[model samples]
Target: MLKLTDKQALEFGIQPVHHQMDNGELRFRLTRDTGSSYILTLSAEQSGWQSSHVHLRKREFYIVEQGWIVLALRQSEQLTFRRLGPNDSFMLPPGLPHNVYLSEGSVLHTVKYGSADADWEAAPELDEKLRHETFDGKTFFTR
Candidate 1:
């Protein structure tokens, strides 16, 4: 079994991130095998204007484990936002623009299946986006 201790994980530089439209937290897990896959968690304390303009080559799956989240999805200009809480599993297909906002103290388990390349676009694009910023504007710099 893969047992990742908090100390080991933090020692490995596991850092909280500040993502678009969030003022909370962001954690990450990445695995590169025959399939390009990763697991990311987002916890939000603010509303989101987040989005994914990149199309996926494979399906993306997400489950809310902590609090709640709102997903903004665009289909041919038909915009929709869905609120999701714990025990919610959303599977998004390729080529769709989607963004998720984590509610207060929210935690999400997100994973992508198969080798997929997707462009990431969180609307309100900030060229000043410094990577490793926490959802709370706390910046954690990395190489």
Candidate 2:
């Protein structure tokens, strides 16, 4: 008989997972259904950041797990802002920009229902927030 751990399964292509960075925040894609869609887990501990931009080929959804964050997204970076909380979530209805700012010790569990490339970029003006940020694309170790 043979068995596989989650990490092992991930490496063997039996499972698909990806982790990313939000300046200093910790975020990941865990337990994905590659045949159709997938889900993501985004964890972060940050402050003083209030904006970002994203280019997604498919719509994306997010569900918060813990802590607090402010989501301000737009089609032209000049639109109105929307805020979210620990028990709150939202969807980016495809081809729009997404900006998520993390409060201290904030963690989010996101569920994406499509297979598309997402181009995520934090505002260049957020250099102040990047200081002491704890994201390394795999795990987070606070400063």
Candidate 3:
């Protein structure tokens, strides 16, 4: 994994054209012409949520670059919740139902591979409220 500087993150974040989903989530597509793989950065400020969906053809990895996030994963009939901070990452394989909830002002750097387009379903019925903390390498609660 690459450790991004503030300037690099800002520059990369500004490159892709972003759009809002039917659920009102906001994501910036960072990579163009990458062919079979794409990068995206999600914003909590826009929708207060992340990807509440499942991919059947590609694998998705959520890497926390800034702030904090509480991720919910439902695989096979089991559900789990995890709180992650900067540099922490989690992978959701194909056929797994996963949802990520942003902590007010969270930012997640995500990557999807092995598929050119997304074959997924958005899960709006699994809405949740997350309670967690962020570690910014300085003050834990000052973010």
Which predicted model would earn the best TM-score?
3
The stretch of ten residues in a row with the least summed lDDT in candidate 1 is 125-134
Give the clash count for each candidate. 7, 0, 0
Q: What lDDT tens digits, residue by residue, belong to model 1 across residues 41-126?
A: 76555644343444456667888887777666666756565667788888888767766655567778877765534435444332
Worst 10 residues of 3 by lDDT: 134-143
lDDT of 2 by residue, 43-90 (tens): 444453534555455556767667665555554534444556668988
User: What ranking of all candidate models by lDDT puts the best one first?
Assistant: 3, 1, 2
lDDT of 1 at 14: 53
Q: List per-prediction Cα lDDT, in the order shown.
A: 0.57, 0.54, 0.62
Model 2: lDDT to the true structure: 0.54
TM-score-wise, the better of 1 and 3 is: 3
Better of 2 and 3 by lDDT: 3
lDDT string for model 3 (19-113, tens) is 77655556677543332334555554443445467788778788888777766777555666677888899987887777766655566777777
Candidate 3 stretches greater than 4 Å from native:
1-15, 20-26, 31-37, 40-42, 124-143
